[model samples]
Target: MKKKILVSACLLGHKVRYDNGNVTCNDPRFLKWSEEGRFVYICPEVAGGLPTPRPDSQIRGKRVVTGAGDDVTKEYEKGAQAALKLAKDNNVALAIMKQDSPSCGSLYVYDGTFTDTKKLGEGRAVALLRQNGIKVFGEDQLDDVEKELKKINIL
Candidate 1:
């Protein structure tokens, strides 16, 4: 049996991206895992009541703020909390988040400049997961995630 793994909806071919588009990697390796029912797709932003093609957001000064400097941290935090709940409900051990997303970003995110400047930024959901002792992995780290999952001995 395959262990549950949290995944960003966009990466799983869902239209939950920031631009109202899907980040469908459609990678054979990921698809195989999905076919095995190991994936738990999520969209933290929408789960927080935000809409599709929503305004780009980022973390600034330890808060999840929007490009306009509005304090939307509560929204993001709520989303994070919800994601955690889902993870717990599904008994997920590993999470694959979207790269460079304000809600799902795992490794790289914009510099909050609303421009094309990307720096090391973590989404609110990612932060919450780490704090709760859950193993988080960015999209780029799929290989590492796979290796770690393999060590779980859940077969």
Candidate 2:
């Protein structure tokens, strides 16, 4: 009877980051969610047709690009679009994405200036979901996500 919650795979220690690195954390909330089978992990960057250990991408003036002179905004957009399909297919009601990431950042993405300054930007996946009326939030807003999840009853 657990409702599905979409989470960024990297946050759960998945080796799907742009550099093929994992952001392993001992977050009790995620651990509990995983144990309860409530977490549906995803990596939009990888899913969008980018390989692991790919170029480091950033959002510059609303476009996605990498440091290696590779412009992958279209790829990121495609990936984000794909993530939405997955979310919809899974009946996901809540999402917990990584903060400040080009792929998973739901709130406060980089300003694209590459000066380590972030300016309230939305990742491709987050933007698409919100546009489709799906509730998206960052990990810091787990309370809100959990609250919404609890409001739904499955089986």
lDDT of 2 by residue, 42-127 (tens): 88998889998887788887689887657899889988988888888787877888888887788788877667788887888888
TM-score for candidate 2: 0.89
Task: Report the error of model 1 at residue 58, Å.
Answer: 1.6
Estimate, for each residue in 1-155, the C-alpha lDDT of model 1 and write its tens digit. Answer: 34589998888888876678757867677888888888898899888878788777877767777777777878788889999999988988889998888777778877877777888867889888888888888888878887887788542
TM-scores of the candidates in the order shown: 0.91, 0.89
Give the clashing pairs for model 1. Answer: none
| Among all candidates shown, the one with the greatest TM-score | 1
Q: How many residue pairs clash in each candidate?
A: 0, 0
Give the residue spans of candidate 2 off by over 4 A: 152-155
> Residue 72 deviation, candidate 1, in Å?
1.9
Q: Give the winner by lDDT.
A: 1
Instruction: Find the 10 residues in a row with the least total lDDT in model 2.
Output: 146-155
Off by over 4 Å in 1: none
What C-alpha lDDT do the candidate models reach, one value each? Answer: 0.82, 0.81
